[model samples]
Target: MKAYILQKDSQSLDNLCLIERPDPVPGPGQLLVRMRAASINYRDQAIVTGGYFGGRVKRDTIPLSDGAGEVVAVGPGVSRFKVGDRVAGTFFLGWVDGPPVGRRTARGAPADGVLAELVVLDEIDAVALPPHLSFEEGACLPCAGLTAWHAVVEACRVRPGDTVLIQGTGGVSLFALQFARASGARVIGISSSDEKLERARRLGLETGINYRRTPEWGDEVQKLTGGRGVDHVIEVGGAGTLARSMQALAFGGRIALIGVLSGHQGDTNPHPLVMKGGSMHGVVVGNRAMFERMNRAIEINGIRPVIDRVFPFAEARAAYEYQQSGALFGKVVIAI
Candidate 1:
């Protein structure tokens, strides 16, 4: 088997390398997966370059939470999957249902990841892929896709006629755009690129706010919504944009604080939440139950994940480089 590892104690991509290793065998309640594809997340880059969870790579780690593969073998006591089933691993290995137990449960960072050509996962920690999606598309679901679903759909409770404001054109933002549109909400997408915003328009975006042009893009959002503000804000920009995201929300609206793209902590007026009676909920990628539920919606709505680029398995490092470039509009995938 071949896998990429972020070598122990080093966080720079300079330390990442590919090596051959013995193929892993599935133990009790596990499945041996022949990986078909994997997608890169911002957190993946953070882990590889020492930007995640205090910028420390504690050990050599396989580094992706989003991947899709075919089950080639199943160990004893596994009933959730069978040989040749197409599946993707959950972001949290042990979270099957309900609320999250802790952040330590995540994959890719502080745990062996799915960047390998072959891997073993507990059967319950993986979910069946949507029938219509290609393996590359399925690979985009576990982290970015699930987080968007958890934030916009489940946490914010988006509904028909409601307005949703999604920040940027990264994986989670694009997925939130699709899911919100599928739910009949009026979708407004924020991006720095006019070209990307136009592309988003073709993807069911009702309106586009170029943050560069309108620095207070949230105010622009208000103007677009006729001063009513938006019902939901898929807030992925952390402190740098949360204040604006807060200003963009309608009275009593909800903000799903999902990412720390602009660093984690900063000063902000609490008046936005206080004055509007709005709520901000911290979002982590969700559990298996949410993953399964999101898959059902993906299947029924015929939603296909927007993959910005695909690199061959041998070009895994380049894929990481592209993700770090901050130029990708959607998910960056590796075809294994």
Candidate 2:
């Protein structure tokens, strides 16, 4: 099996080399998957750069948590799937249900991940991809799609006629917009690029705010809502945008703090949250149960994940570089 390995003291993409390793066999209750596709998440970049979750990596590590493939073999006690079943593994290997508790429950960290020709996972840790989706599309679901679904549908519980704000046109934001639209919510997408905003409008985004042009985007959002702020905000900007997100919320509005794409540190006033009776919820990528529920919604609604680019498995480093370039509007995939 060919795999990308991240070694200690390697901070550059050049360090991620494709190497041959013995194919792994499925352990008890697990299945061996012949990977067809894998998608890169922002977290994968952090891991490769030695900054994910403040953890250290000593051994060469396979990087990406999201992948789709066909089951090649099954271990003892594995019954949920059989050979030739197409499936994608959940990012969080041990978390099958409920809310995330501690740091140990995290996924896509230093652990050997799915950026390989083959990988093994527990039967319950994998879910069937939507029949209508391609392997590339299925590869986009496990991390970004599941996080967006959990934020808008499960955690925020966005209702019809409710207004939601999504920052940027990254994978999670685009998925959030699609899921919010499917749930009958009015979506307002914030981006710095007018071109990307136009693209978002075609994807059912009802309103688009070019944050670069209008620095006071929170005010623009308020104006768009006729003085009533949005019901929910998918706060991907982290501390840099948190203050404005606070200003853009209606009374009792909920903000799902999902990422810190902007500088990790920024100042935010607590008075607005208290005065407006709103709450901010920290959202890590979700669990296996959430991924399954999200897949059900995706199948029911016939939702398609937006893919920005597909790189060949040999160009995994190039794919990561592209993701870091920030020129893409949606998920970046590696076809294995």
Among the numbered candidates, top lDDT falls to 1
Clashing pairs in 2: none
Would you give me the overall lDDT of model 1? 0.91
Candidate 1 C-alpha lDDT tens digits along 75-113:
999998999899999998899998876654677877788
TM-score between model 2 and native: 0.97
Candidate 1 stretches with Cα past 4 Å from truth are: none
Candidate 2, overall lDDT? 0.89
lDDT of 2 by residue, 1-336 (tens): 999888765577777888999999999999999999999888888777776666555677777889999999999988899999999998876787876866643445556788899998889889999999999999999889998998998889999999999999999999999999999999998998999999999999999999989989999999999999999999999888999999999999999989988867766788998999999888877888888888888999999999999999988989999998969898999999
Q: For residue 94, what is the lDDT in candidate 1?
A: 91
Clashes of each: 0, 0
CA lDDT of each prediction against the hidden true structure: 0.91, 0.89
The numbered model that scores best in TM-score is: 1
